[model samples]
Target chain A: MKQLVRTIVLSDSYAQSSQNSPELEERDPYNRLLARQRGIRLPAELIRDNALTVSGLLNPEIGGRSVKPYQPAGYYQHLNFPRRKYAEDLNENQYRRGLYTHWQRTFLHPSMKAFDAPAREECTMVRESSSTPLQALVLLNDPSFVEAAKALAAESEDILDMFERALTRRPTAAEVAVLEELLASEESRFAADAEAVGQLLGVGMKGVSADQRSQLAAKTSVARGILNLQETITRY
Target chain B: MNPYFLDHLKRRTFLENSFTGIGAVALAGLLGRQESLGAPSGIPEAKSGTGILGEKRHRPVKVKRVIHLCMAGGQSHLESFDYKPKLAELDGKPMPASFTKGQQLAQLQKQAGKLKCMGPQFEFTKSGKSGQEISNVFPHLQKVADEIAIIRSMQTEQINHDPAHTFMNTGSIIPGRPSMGAWVNYGIGSEAEDLPGYVVLTSEGGGQGQPISSRQWSSGWLPSQYQGVQFQSKGDAVHYVANPPGVSRDAQGELVDSVNKMNRLFGKTRHDPEIEGRIAQYEMAFKMQASVPGLMDVSAEKPETLERYGCQPGDGSYAANCLLARRLAERGVRFIQLYHRGWDHHGGIKANFEKTANLVDQGTAALIRDLKDRGMLEDTLIIFGGEFGRTPMAQGSGRDHHINAFSMFLCGGGVNGGVTHGATDELGYAAMEDPVHVHDLHATMLHLLGIDHLRLTYRFQGRDFRLTDVFGHLIKPVLA
Candidate 1:
């Protein structure tokens, strides 16, 4: 069994290959010889982990009791056996890896379910990968993602830096242009409304000093756009 | 022969053996091509959002939609629809040991030896033209008695709450199977573009609210999209339906547009279909932001309509959910399940059952009447029942869970109203006449929706898994 495992791991097909290679472009169902460079979206746990890892909010510590991160209010409204009210982990556990997130067999965390996490009521052979509006909503509106965006904005120097932090590469000129325009518009909007800025900043446990509120909110918008990119969540 | 064994029959063997083999015959029937004796027709042709079965069904469609009103905890048949005067006369006497000898019992298992008979809690009156005897607690339902077909001999395998709920919903006590709503939605798809195909709404009041898990509506082993999306009556109708605190609607729209643009640009280099799917979902998410809020706003509903349902809009009551079910039916949601989780009456059967009945009776009758009035009754199927029934034997003032017999009702679309099918014994101990098992109910439901229960199978783990799972017989008397 060990020799078989070694042989399988050392196989030529297991070697890393560039996804962009023209040699991998066989379209026929039967005649396809090389593996294509299709990007598989990271599982629900890793998706959350990637966002936190890039934002520098991940606790990095492993092996502990399951944690509860920020979730929408009344997500557990239907849940009863004692009629639970979801209270997120207040300490650093809030930023812990998604692997440690509580697995409620019946009602799983919504954000995780959106990214195709199994309910774990029974053994699952393979996790299904689905793209739906709920996934978009999770990335765009879930407080955990929003909190990660805020943290990413605070740490980055600019939009390009934010892109680098999130996607592991600097954006093209066209991408930078679009983000700069979004940042400028968001800055003006936040400057006009102090309450909106306060709402955006007062998301997670961490708080920024009052002086850099508007600027930070604008950068967060830019950071949010970068984090929400399809490439950011997809593992090539 | 069990269809499960046919998974081992290879295609070459099936073809070479031709028309003589049992494997070929079963395969032909499963593929819905027994008449043709050739390749299955319309195998690849599916309706827009439907799963396997597509537009071509095994039989002619009778109902276009299904709305299951699940009374989550065990609802007693003795008090509700089943009229047993003999049980009332024998009340307070020791129950016949012959009836419950070695029978599965729930909370009353400990007191099995000294079990005392309990009569119907509420008074029964023959109501409507059919003279269907119903409990006085359901006064509103009594008015619409002729519009329903009551089944008194409903039997289930599981006696406990959670597993029985699973059995009632998915036709199996085991988890990880597509729910009834999921199966129906997957078969025909939905007409509502903005809303989900299968929608679940829940409310609780009157008794100890048992936890109705999200698994009740899950599309287990099926594609995730077919799973039921819970629409909360209060707050944001769907989780994350609302934008983040600071983001305006216009800002969110701008962000969506920008994200889609970036996705399209990324697609040029990657050539992955998922990128395009991601782009489409963002647009859908933005559309849901607008549609869901409008859907939840019931202020536009006329005062008379609100009065009929006996609910203030946005109060998160069963009445409001019934109203919403109608709205959802109108918009073409394929399956809508409204779970009222307060029916487990272990102690105070009379008072607790009455309170719970009051919570759902008016709304249930209102929904039936409203649908009939709207001309949607002909194509909409309404199922009202719980997981299982309560015992005839008493546990103090209440009853224990009984698997021998229960009651449920069918109304609207292809149902012979003003009729009672099947019956329990004189003592209301067990189903004596025409017992309707959970699988039979599932089969009949699928039959009404124009699907053959045996044919609508999903192959998983080398076995053809169906809702009925090798068991199911249609309850023919109730069919219109």
Candidate 2:
């Protein structure tokens, strides 16, 4: 069933360009007529996948028990019936797919739920995909994202190369400017509060690779900003 | 980017509501949709201020909203609400063959039929002008005795913790039924724009508190939008409520705007109705970022009021949640379900049950008193009870699960105040007169809320399911 579904969706008719005229835009606002393919924010799983896959860190191992990524402390403390405690994974499991995160019904992992993932208590049919400030917060502050940014920054210092590596496309001029400004501002901010840089670098189970702290911190900031791009979270 | 709305988009919500003037059929049909069947046809992506899109009621109801405090782990009826003077007279006596024979009772002990009858650990006396006999366990609740209608003969099928709670909230011992809160949301819709129609708040006390999951308050077959949102008692108050540490409020706004820019861009490409829906949700969530924090902050409240409710600013106690519930009621949230756990006193009933009673008594009474003081009690229905009640016989030092007869209380809905609805037998073993089943309670609650119990239903697994499950009658005696 899975192979058949994938084969049908992989066909050319399934993937079309959305570059039609404004008239076409108005007439088929929901694209019901199949004029072109529309851009969409990626599903909760792929949002995490795109980050890990771009960096060399994705484990590529499949079919295992769910793993615990970096979540805030006392996140699951409220979960009773013999109160549960979140045990974050420190090994390769931490880099697994978003699907591998521990699925607690009462207390779901904060970042994934922000991306409109249901609590998974029952069969969910049409999952609502919402773009909220919480989602932006997840992209910006969640340790998983921070860790991904640090890993991507370690791959390359050049901004354009980093974008190509993560986004699988060369950076557009406008996108480059957003990244550059974030990098410059974050560098100055972190330089003043070196403790803040230490904090960003201190996110994941694994620590940052040994390098000049200030330079790596700036690069990490740039990578973090790029990862927060609307394009990064969306599928065109 | 434009901070103000584009001329066409400014009144987009107004036009949508005005255009689809079909009333609650539009709202009801929107709140419920099969996932594979897809979102209902012609449902607008976004509406102005996310209140009900005109709920078409069966009739005008006196009770406009509800506040339910679900006492998880059943509260012991014999010790608290139902006072059996005969049981005290016959304390430590073996169960008579007349009551035990031919009756298949729940047994957690090896010698089930030979169990000894236990008397009430606490004293009961008439309280308030109406003279209802409340136990000594709740000193604070005694003051508002006249404001409540106590049901002494409430019955249910489930005797276990999980299933019983399931039955109480969703009207089914089996899982996967839509909760009462969800049904109410689908029926009348929410009034708050920045909050969900059905909001849940859960707290813990010092007994054998059961675990609460999303299932109790889930939307079931209803679309997920109708499901309850459990606001947190600590931290940022809701999931992902706080901005990441370093980002300032302006930066958060910038981030939301930038993200919205792309979402709107994506919407233009697909015209996917979900895109517009997503945009609306993002804006609502953005608005909620400000509103939720404001709602959680109780610093502006008078010190005496906080002291009266026994609520501290940041503590997630039952008192604090009760205070928060009133604030939510004021904001027009359709349903607020607060769950206070640790009521299950299986053994050592005297010592353990008192702790939970004290923990909740003040806050529960204060909620009713506060609502009445604010002139909101007439429109707001408040229910206080557990999933089931405990037996008259002792299990070790505590009581076992008893479903033959239990107790629950109603206040400030359309029910008569200071009234006792039903009666149980002398030994408190069973409801011999005016018995009210779980379904009947559900029916009465729905009737009070302007929904016909049979009329509100969702089809799942080829069977239509309502909160009362086709077996409930309007509890007429309790109604004013």
Candidate 3:
């Protein structure tokens, strides 16, 4: 097994002598294809083959709403996008396209700036060393983080129900007690000011405060509870 | 250790069986340990590998902080710092074919008419006792000319916006390396425990000239904590930083205590390094929720300061960002990078270039004066320049990108004042003597900060990396 592992490693590097060659391209397609792949559907498909082109995902007419990609960005150029008229939605007047003509060689992505995506340049393997207190803070309090967490939780709720369905034997008394304690805490927190918040909004509160700071201190305490619940930051 | 294979030892005594089983398991454990240890060398030590958490710098530094006023796009050397008399002699004449040798031109070349070498659109006069010939365009910067070190031969690797911006910010023309600000944060952690070490500010015309993005101030291989925290000059600088609903500050504290308790238990079991970072960040975030909003508020500033930086109290602009940078510097932010973009005056050379210069020059001079008044100038280093310079020859009426040579100004800290360390050719086409590449400039800046560029390294991908990246030399002439 050791010798086989060594052989595999050697052959892999030998086959991929150049990191960005056709060999590696053939070997990995699905992993490299993000969001626009089989599962998570992208509204428009950006063809990366040669010319920068944007094609619609649906049939050419009905849901096949596609517009031509905008011009590539130049040095010191204003990042502006073209406007499109849609009869159905007044808000769909303009949308900004990416900077590259399809991932230009050394240029940065505008979306990467809008969304802080790591620009992998110097090395292939980036080490995620945990040192600063900012990372967790940003995750807990950054509005972007709050939105992502809520979206992720909502999507994974169905999977959580599936975990409950697959159970052949009920949990032990201790396990049941632990879950009950968590639910009880959530209930108590909700009871504290749900009515007050609802009154401010001129409606009764439907749920506990979704504010992350309220949950900021509770994130880690409930992280295990969350991970053990069924889905681990994943939909399935 | 395969249990099925051990079963074949029928003749083995009970004691022998016990000994052999234990030995087999121990051997297996040893092999597994090596596999786990196979990760590349220890997390990169400090460049010199002498201090705890990379705190030991190359020397005892005088500069406690740095505020780099990055002029994005291309700030014209001709109109601002570099004064060329020969351009007047060759005004509207064709650029000699000999001068065009091997030079690639941006769209400006195709549009340039008969190589019109227009002289300074604005007048140039000697400023202060140093007799530095600064253009009238920078009336304010001229006041501090005696305290500035202007390097007219400063050059870069690229002419285009994205690459040049990336090269200036990070060491490489490519993205993903730690930015200079991030490196400073990594080398010298933070004086303030609650706030971030590095902070970024931008001017209102959208910090146009330089490409200001997360990559410009990213921590890269270093932990994300070292990354610059961007605080806008307008409207609650950081988004979603407001306190959540229904949670009193005390209630929030209680929740944090509960989370920390659980984390302590999990950390003991898993020994995850990130777990500790998370705990620290959570506490910092809680504290930041109170401090950050206060820090960004400028309503308390005296009217004089507001007029000095040309800042509108509630508006976000370059002038506002410049003043905010000073505030952050006072608050102990190790590195404050300000990007004021829109300097590329390719079309309306006279009209556009002059306008952009007016926008920056006054505010920049005010920052220097403000720092000096506060007694922070002595220990605070300030850098002002763009990625590269505009061409010596005309591109139509406007100048194109000239990477061969340009100008940059350094003031305060340990830089020698009233000096121009290098020179460009007669036409200012290229560096004639004492050529300083971006790497060399980086080295010299680090040197002023008491950091040796070569020695200040972070190991990444089995090799040590640095801001200068295998090539950089401290220009001893510029140092005091």
Q: Each predicted complex: what DockQ?
A: 0.28, 0.14, 0.12
lDDT of each residue in A124-226, candidate 2, tens digit only: 5545444444565577667788788888888885888888887687755655666666667666766777666676677676777655776677777677666
State the lDDT of candidate 3 residue by residue for B1-480, as single tens digits: 332122111111111111121122112222223223221233323221112224455676868788899888878888877787777667677666666655676765564444556565667888878888788888888998988988988888888876787899887987667788878766666665557778787663422343455556766655445667666455555543544444456555555554554444444433222334345555666667777777777778899998988868536567777887788888887888887777876766887777788788878988899999999999999989988888867766677777888889889878888787788777777787899888998888778777777666654433567799989988777778
The candidate that achieves the highest TM-score relative to the unseen native structure? 1
Task: Point out where model 1 deviates above 4 Å.
Answer: A1-53, A57-135, A157-222, A225-236, B1-48, B245-284
Model 1: per-residue Cα lDDT over B305-398, one tens digit each: 8889998775678988999999989888899999998888999999999999999999999999989998999898899999999888888999
Pairs that collide in candidate 1 are none
- Relative to the true structure, how large is the alpha-carbon lDDT of every model? 0.79, 0.73, 0.56
Model 2 / residue B215 / CA error / Å: 1.2
Q: Which residue ranges in model 2 land beyond 4 Å of their true spot?
A: A1-143, A146-236, B1-55, B102-104, B107-109, B245-284, B459-464
User: TM-score of A-chain in each prediction?
Assistant: 0.90, 0.88, 0.30
Better of 1 and 2 by lDDT: 1
Model 2's alpha-carbon lDDT is: 0.73
lDDT of 1 by residue, A1-236 (tens): 99998986687644545253323332421113435333568999999999999999999988989899998776677564668778899999999999999876557888997787876655555565556677888999888899999999998888888898888887787788788888888999999999999988988788876467899998888878878999999887
